[model samples]
Structures are given as structure tokens and as C-alpha cells.
Target: MTTEAVLDIAVQALMVAAKLCAPVLVTALVIGLVVSLVQSMTQVQEVTLSFVPKALGAAIALVVTGHWMISTIVTFTTDLYTRMPALVGH
Candidate 1:
């Protein structure tokens, strides 16, 4: 394959990865911010307080978004497989 084709595939893979990760990352970030604010307000800064909620938020995000994530990845994989012959021949 041409350099540009290879680069395109690489970029697409990166985008898919980022898309899959964004929900969990954003959930963790928002939860962490809220936990930080609460800790600041209450003067109760237990490490687990922040850690647990962010973890739970991430898990919840994964649970909520799991179907979409799987479908996206499956679509990408199917497309890649369908293109494999073309990609390998040249």
C-alpha cells in the first residue's frame, strides 16, 4: 500500500481509540472535579472518597456506552477485514 493509505489507516485507528475512550475519561474527569469541590467544601479529604466515585463513574460510563462502543469497533473491524485484500495486494 501507499504511504498515504497506511497513514490513513493509522489515523483512523487512533480516532476509533479516542472515540472509545472519551466517555470513560470524561466521566472520570467530571466526577473527580465534583469530588474535589465537595472535599474542599467539607474539609474531608479522604483519598478513597475521590478515587471510588471516579472509578464508579467510569464503570457507569462503560456500562451505559458499552453497546455503542462495541458496535463501533465491530464496524471498524468489519471494514478493515473487507479492505484487507485490497490493502495487501498492492
Candidate 2:
């Protein structure tokens, strides 16, 4: 494969990874920010106070987006496989 083809594949893989991770990462970030704000306001410095909510939020995000995420990855993989023969000039 040419360098350009390799770079294209790498870029596509990175984009797919970022798309898959975005939902859960955003959920956790939002939850953590809110928990931090509440902790600062209420002076509740408990570890679980911040941890539990962010974990639950991330879990909920994953649950909600799980099907879409799976379909997206499967589609990407299928497309990559379909393109492999051409990429390899076979």
C-alpha cells in the first residue's frame, strides 16, 4: 500500500474511535463538572459523591448509545474489509 493509503486508513480508524468514545466521555465530563460544582457549594467532599454520579452517567450514556455504537463499528469494519482487496491491489 502507498503512504497515502495507509494514512487514509489511519485517519479513518481514528475518526471511528473518536466517534465511538465521544458520548461516554462527554457524559462523564458533564457529570463530573456538575458534581464538582455541587461539592464546592455544599462542602461535601466525599469521594463517592463525585465518583458514583459520573460512573452512573457514563453507564447510562453507554446503555443509550450502545446499539448505535455497535452498528457504527460494525459498519466501519465491514467497509474496511470490503476495501481491503482494492487497497492491497488484489
CA displacement after TM-score superposition, residue 57 of candidate 2 (Å): 0.6
Residue 46 CA error for candidate 1 (Å)?
0.5
lDDT for each residue of candidate 1 in 1-90, tens digit (9 for 90 to 100):
778879989999999999999999999999999999999999997999999999999999999999999999999999989888898884
lDDT of 2 by residue, 2-90 (tens): 89989998999999999999999999999999999999999989999999998899999999999999999999999999989999998
Tell me the TM-score of model 2. Answer: 0.97
**Deviation of model 2 at 75, angstroms:** 0.7
Stretches off by above 4 angstroms in model 2 are: none
* RMSD, every candidate, angstroms: 0.9, 0.6
> Where is model 1 poorest over a 10-residue stretch in terms of lDDT?
81-90
- The local lDDT score (0 to 100) that residue 39 gets in candidate 2 is 95
